[model samples]
Target: MKIVRPFSFVLAIALFTPAIRAQDGVKKDDKANTAISYYKDVRPILQQHCQGCHQPAKAQGGYVMTDYPNLFKKTEKEVIGVVAGKPADSELVKQITAHDGKKPAMPRGKDPLTDRDVTIIKQWIEQGAKDDTPASAKLPTVDANHPPVYTQSPVINAIAYSRDGTLLAVAGYHEVLLHKADGTALVARLIGMSERIQSLAFSLDGQWLAVTGGNPGRFGEVQIWNVEKRTLKMSIPITFDTVYGASWSPDSKLIAFGCADNSLRAISAETGKQVLFQGGHGDWVLDTVFSVKGTHLVSVSRDRSMKLTEIATERLEDNITSITPGALKGGLQAVDRHPTKDELLIGGADGTPKLYQMFRTKDRKIGDDFNNIRNYGTMPGRIFAVKFNADGSRVVAGTSYDGKGEVRVYETTTGKLVSTAKGVNGPIYAVAHHPKESVVASAGFEGIVHLNDAVTGALVRDFVPVPVKGAKK
Candidate 1:
């Protein structure tokens, strides 16, 4: 006869065997029934592909997918976008599903969604289309009426004067504040969803303002605002980080900007469609400027090089800077095209304001920085901003170091120092010259907008762009 095991041992084996089987069964069920999250899965797909055209500011075809509730609402065609527990019957599923080998009808002009993304969206709807967006992820409604309240002055990354010299646009938290040229009164607050305003530019005709920025890690956006109507005309979401150096084309038909992803991009100012894309930079592209005629784009990058790209062909025409190692002392941070010429005013980590011809006139040589026109006297710190006057006769550069900032004006041709602005403290990240007047606007680590006389460099006036909770307006 077989030896009998102890009673305790037998009991333990029996208990452990069923427990292992039960655990395995639970894990398998969990793996099969995993819930698809609207916030985590579906939202990102929409944000990357659909939100640009379907947000509140731009409800394409009278349908919006920016919010979960909007997905279930009926579209302009009276078709429900999503129907809970029935993916096959949902209009959204129908629109996204290929038919007769034809591409999906939605996301017009863009590539069809990947099979995986479409499957995820369908699965989410099939699982009852529940709202699982966390409260912490919800952003407060911010607009002109419900503007962002500031406890302290936000870091000013950019400032611009309207083409007509009537209004000044200063970058603030989630908004661009329009002030009178004299800085005595606030005109209007143009607000958007981007938290960081990296650059601001007004169209040549002064009808629109182009803004570039975004949540640092989430997304980048190019915002076109109708200045006269004070309304957001277009919001084009781009790469997965903040964008910089927004500049409008001469005809105001296109807006170009630099990206943290080392690419340069341009989009139609009207429809927000990407019309141009150039990805030649080796590092983060920090600034960009369009050639005077708008035929080409010049982008400066943290790779310590300036590159020229042909807009028509999306071809990288040349590296404007020298290809020799260590030609640039450091990465470039700012660039501005001359008002009427194919010349550029640039500044960056080296603290020198440089003027460079946009196009190469001679054959390329590896060691030659042939396009470099002139180099102004080095400032005390890194130059974060450089701008040409309305006539391109004078250039202003702003810098910051050792917790102090300085603004210097130089004669563009002779490289003669015009004046150094007085009474500037903190790191200066932005500077703008009035289109018609002698006023120069500067702001940075300190949130106050300082208007100085461009000729004499005397402080004209300074004011906080935002309303401080306890301070006078």
Candidate 2:
């Protein structure tokens, strides 16, 4: 079955075959391009045919085909340019074959960007492009400085890279029993939590692991374990209710959580002290997060509001009365902050993930129109989980579309949907990006983790040993 993309978009695979390419990472002289190295000759081809609009500053119709990363980063629409290395499986080539200049052609206007130009883009991206930036004038590209994140596991749910991205804390049931990013090997299993773990986070100093959303005896639960001691430290009861979210502050001085309680509460990280708790929402509190500065925290609730609180003073700073366009009757499902920028991105039970100004103060009411200032827009599904990529330039969201789900990648500044991994049979329960590599681990209704190529959305690994629900030991 052929999925069609425009002339520039082709889901090409970029793989190096051992049969032809040398096993030592170098390809044999006769080996073909992996869609990446095909760049040197293809840049001019794109510049001449498609660069009039799809250049750096302006990508037409939200699509840019100038470079490999930007091309993949800008648009992952079905049948688009270079789907990795699969040439015969590319959509661009197919579109070129369609010469009617009908609704389905490239460059879409006066002159069709010729068939040869389309072929070169398909071949170059698959072969990989060369770095053309002048070291003196151009800033370093993310790829040149930071590599892809967690490459193993394929599907990542809750990932907290040790302060340095050198170590990772990943949670899953089956064999995600535990592995390190470096591969030195250590038992990932630490006992006492429920067999069904949901989210994972590490303390600021990397001394503890806070695992939330699993069984809490019958009081439901939230427990903190000391990593070095390997013993349970303190247990915070979730008021005999279901748990929704959990997080630790940047200073390691506080631990905050949200829930059926309708409001978010902060407690002392060391004493498990009730730092402060408020109740106002008539419904559940779905997600909560602490800003990187440690000065504030934000929460999304079933009350149809996004609330930001100043932790130190225990005061409400800004309240996003309703996250949806019309205050839609749904809850906010997930929330996350940027790595360095003063911005907070939120996802809702309805299908839009809105951004927020992290610097907004309590006295200045952001009001309902806050979305206008923060770049609010629609999402492909009910955003369930959200996390920033290593640099915070992009965001990863787990979404639900028509009861089925996938993870979507978007630019933080423009609120544009750049990539999506769809067609999963059920709602995606969670989505998380790797701290260091282009690896993503997502798990939903079926329980098995679906690891996908974070950049291309291709299936990289299936962590399901057995039909998660259909088979039993």
Candidate 3:
């Protein structure tokens, strides 16, 4: 076998071996060169960690990362956030990466980005940082001028009357409809980017409106609107899901709200900066209210507990509800503080409304709901909304059962059934009492705002809050 090899065969073997080795090297290079997309791989990282502070309304440090072009712009300190093809020279990379065993600087007060996320962002910048966002992924412009067009009325989840009793804010799709309290005319439309508005509140001074909502699985937002100017003052994006139960402090200096992440948070009204964070709830916090003095925050949760937290120290002070198992049959959904006292009116899955004193008047004992003041008669279904009248004389609760809805008014001290609003057609999610008049506005799945006489329970008038396309007014 060794004696009969041809010269051409030997030459061919040598050439083919080197060629195959070179081809293998090329395949490895191709795998390393795989593109990293800004939209698919990098944008989500920013949305989760950075956009909460760097969005348009809360552009901390003058860096806005919500849009692609804003990434390459100069910062307030004249530093470039991202430099194409040079991750080491990029300010964004420097801020997110650690040096001398210290944590990253950006995403201040939060945990640093995961190693994998950091690598993806660096890789995207190294690949020239191209924007690969598709047309469908782009957010539509929604604001005061370019308002949301509703083909049909959206399910109203919240409504509130201004402190002056002149304006009614109704939750709508991507907006809050401001109507005259009489329900005769639409006054203004406060449009924003959130798809669902969960809760609404007017500042005690009647100068500002606070709203909580978000895109269902994407983000949570807190919007502060200037009531008189009809302008969006600030938009603060927070958790991953919609937030609920926004309430303003008595001084209007801070706003507190419940989050889907089982946490309660408060922010500065002027700066949109998070000032207080409490994580005592075992389930999603459904509603929140400040104590009369604004020193304590009372939050009701789906965990069947109402926990109080001290705002100054950010510590859980007490569990106002009994913690004994089976004491609270279901989760709590709505909460409202008394107009003049420290009493709380709460309702939820149990369909019963119970008032609890905000502070403990006695020592705690096992299995004792010591703060329970009085129990109002139960409604026909799960209560989604509750409120006390101007003078704290009466309370209103809205409920939904099967396909029908009911709104009930009750005397606060005597616990007597005052009246039940008539002509409600669908599930009721929101109810609000007028500040100076004996009227209550109720709305829900049917999308019609009903003005009912608080004393008589008769429907005074009803109207769809949003303008329906091609439909007569």
Task: Give TM-scores for every candidate, taking all chains together and pairing residue i with residue i.
Answer: 0.87, 0.58, 0.81
What does candidate 2's lDDT look like per residue over 78-183, in tens digits?
4455455555555554544454656436654435655445555555545543455445634322221232222232343454555545554555541123445433
Candidates sorted on TM-score, descending: 1, 3, 2
Full candidate order by lDDT, most accurate first: 3, 1, 2
In model 1, residue pairs whose N, Cα or C atoms come closer than 3 Å (at least 3 residues apart or on different chains), thus clashing, are: none
For every candidate, C-alpha RMSD to the true structure in Å: 11.1, 24.6, 12.9
| Model 3 bad stretches (over 4 Å) | 1-34, 45-122, 125-140
Whole-model lDDT values for every prediction = 0.86, 0.57, 0.88
lDDT, candidate 3, at 126 = 90
Residue-level lDDT of model 1, residues 242-306, one tens digit each, is: 89999888888989898876788999987888888887887778888889888999999887889
lDDT of residue 257 for candidate 3: 94
Distance from true position, residue 402, model 3, in Å? 1.0
Using lDDT as the measure, name the better of candidate 1 and candidate 3. Answer: 3
Candidate 1 segments exceeding 4 Å error: 1-32, 59-64, 67-105, 130-138
Query: What lDDT does candidate 2 reach at residue 79?
Result: 43
Model 3, global lDDT: 0.88
